[model samples]
Each structure stands twice: as C-alpha cells, then as structure tokens.
Target chain A: GESVGLHLPTLSVQEGDNSIINCAYSNSASDYFIWYKQESGKGPQFIIDIRSNMDKRQGQRVTVLLNKTVKHLSLQIAATQPGDSAVYFCAENAGSYIPTFGRGTSLIVHP
Target chain B: EAGVAQSPRYKIIEKRQSVAFWCNPISGHATLYWYQQILGQGPKLLIQFQNNGVVDDSQLPKDRFSAERLKGVDSTLKIQPAKLEDSAVYLCASSLVASGNGGEQFFGPGTRLTVL
Candidate 1:
C-alpha cells in the first residue's frame, strides 16, 4: 500500500507487502529530515534520517528517499508486518535544530 | 543509553483543574523538547530547552502552559485551569545538542492527559 499525499491519515496493506509512506515538507531551507514511527501508547521513535545533501538512506528493512526539488520525503518498508503497524510522521529541521513534524500517516498491516 | 523519561503515564483532570508533568532527559543530553500530540495527529513542539535555557517557546501557550528545565537536567510542564481541548499526549524528547545536524531525538513514553 502507498500513501503519497501530505495528509495521508491511513494506509492498509497485507502482511509481507511493501509499503510506501510519503511526506511533503514545506521548509525550503531544511537541511535535515527524519522519519518516525509511533505505536499505540508510546511516543514517536526515530526510523531513519537524511541530510539535504543526500538523496537516499537505507536501514534495516527501511529506506528513506528525499527529493529536495519537490521537498518530498518517503519511507519504504520492504516487508510490512503486524509489528510495523503504526502512525508514521516526517520531521524537518530548518537549521534551527527544532524539527517541524508533518501530519502523520497511520499504517495498518493485516495478517 | 537510557531513553527520555516522563512521569504520570496517564492523567485525568477536569476543566479548570491544574496539572503538571515531569520529564528527565537521557544522561548527558543537553537539549530537551516538549511536544503535544493530539489523537490522529503528529506531535507539535511546545517548547525547547538547551541546558536550562529556553531556546524556543514560540509555540507554547504562555497564558496557561508553562515549562521549566531547572539545572539543565529534568524539566516540568504545568497547565493551569486545564481545558478539554488540552487533552493530548505530552511527550518529552532529548538530543545531544541543538545543531544543524539535528540529531535524532529519543522520546519518552509520554503522558496521556484527558481533561473532563
């Protein structure tokens, strides 16, 4: 399942499928971007991050792609699992060290 | 390293009541942040502190919301005469420093506030 809009509230996908969650950032001067996953009853946790100078960063089972031209950031999960179900949010630091978070996208993986 | 820690994992209060939340950032971390997360929404920055100094608090509602990080270690957030709209999860996060790199912030479990 894929959600590319700025306000992607939900994404439903089957287990073992790939998932793509997108975020549209508004800061043109942001040099740092991060992706976070928040589970129920817990705070948001860091997923992956990329500097403006970089285009993509990969982590275990996760990949983050950043496009400066369009100010778009996307997180790709290789194999969606039940444990991966959560609300995903993107944060951008516009040189202030204070990140502005985007609206969250809740991903629901079905077994 | 230990993650940020917050007190009162859950809170229940009525309108016009007062409440306070506490936070302890990871050891050695100099930057602390407080965020408010409403249901189905992303967390919003409420205030930021750098070693006991207020860095950014533009988003904080100074009228009723106040926070302080004393001695550059633990912090506290208080709400006077809480309103129903104030119901949300209050999260505390910490990072190494306030820099251009924007180091990943480690978050606490967050205090869920419900105002009646």
Candidate 2:
C-alpha cells in the first residue's frame, strides 16, 4: 500500500543551528503534503504545507520543499530553539483528501 | 476560534474492556477525522466523516471499533474488548471543507489510551 516515511528516526541540532527533516512518499498520485509538529502528550500541530504543483513554500520560520521527481519532501527550520524540540511528521494526501502519515522524525534541539 | 476538543485525556483498562472517546470539532467545520498514533509513530487515519456521512473508514477495525457523528456535529469513537495493541493516542481533527479540496485541519489535544 502507499505510505509516507522519514529518512531518520531522530535528529539532534544545536539551539542556534538550522534543522532539516526529510521524508519520502510512495504514492505518485498524491497532490498535497503537510508537515506537523507533535509535542509530548499533545496532538500533532500543523506547521506548513505544500501542494504538488509547487516545489517549495515558506512559513514564518519553516519551509517545505517537495520534489515530484524523487517523491521526496523536506522541512527546514531556521534557528532551532529548545521549544522546537518535538516529533515532526509528514503527510501526503491523494485524491481522497485522507492523509497518510510517515513514522515521524524526532527533532531534538540542544541549548 | 476554539480548536477541536476531546474528552478523557487518559484512560487505562484491561483487555476485553470497552472504552469510548468523544470529540467536538470546530464550529462550522464540515469535515472530521479520527486518527490513532502509536508510540514512536505517526498518526494513522481510522475514519473520516463529511457532515454526518462516512467518507472513508477502510483502516478502522470494524469488529472492535465503531464511531458515529450525530447531527453532523459532535462525534464519538468506541472500542470494545480492547486489546493490548490498542494502547495509543486517539486524535480528532476538523476542517472547514472536505479535505480532498485541500482544507487545513485543526487537531484536538487527543486522548491517550493504555490497554493492559
């Protein structure tokens, strides 16, 4: 079946450094993608999203890049902070609008 | 606006017991979804409703899990005779329109279930 997956299970970064999380999806038909940040004991929160038609989209302090050719997605965080530490997940939506999520990558920021 | 709301932040029960979780989506939202998040994994869609109607539930374990939305508003999900594997977090979300149209979804705090 079609699924989304992360390249790493966990990533550690300095507080002031930048962070990049990567994801790969199998469904070529998927048209929209979203990135979510999940804190401990909380539901996943929407961070940013990009459609298949666009290669990249920028948010307040985050950016999402989609590569249709490689079926890859990435989220970049500028100036990682302690509060930014959490599990980040990537989801892909096909025609049904029901999103399929990746296993998730834990972002650990060290001060 | 107030975000999605869910009750019973945590629950613990033995195998074979029954449990139910409630969810209230954002007002005026037409689409609602239920997802299960296991430890160290992402949330998985269990079912979706489009204004009191079922849009998809292919991943829901019908034999053990059931859900319903009344009057196209509040919704509830029930699990009967729960198993140890059922221990996870249940998340409810809502969107202004059908997700297929690319509507952004807001999520609730989620209910954590621990089946012994």
Per-residue C-alpha lDDT of model 2 across residues A58-105, encoded as one tens digit per residue: 999899999999999999999999999999999999998889999999
Writing each residue's lDDT as its tens digit, candidate 2 over B1-116 gives: 89899999999999999999999999999999999999888999999999999999999999999999989999999999899999999999999986668788899999999999
What ranges in model 2 sit over 4 Å off? none
Provide the TM-score for each candidate, comma-separated: 0.94, 0.98
Relative to the unseen true structure, what is the C-alpha lDDT of residue B81 in candidate 2, on a scale of 0 to 100?
A: 84
Q: lDDT score of model 1?
A: 0.89
Q: lDDT of model 1 at residue A108?
A: 98
lDDT tens per residue, model 1, B1-116 = 67899999999999999999999999999989999998877888999998999999999999999999889999999999899999999999998976346666999999999999
Worst 10 residues of 2 chain B by lDDT: B97-106
What C-alpha lDDT do the candidate models reach, one value each?
0.89, 0.95
- Cα displacement (Å) at residue B34, model 1: 0.4
Docking class of 2: high
Q: How close to the true structure is residue B57 of candidate 2, measured as C-alpha lDDT?
A: 99
What C-alpha lDDT, on a 0 to 100 scale, does residue A36 get in candidate 2? 94
lDDT of model 2 at position A64 = 97
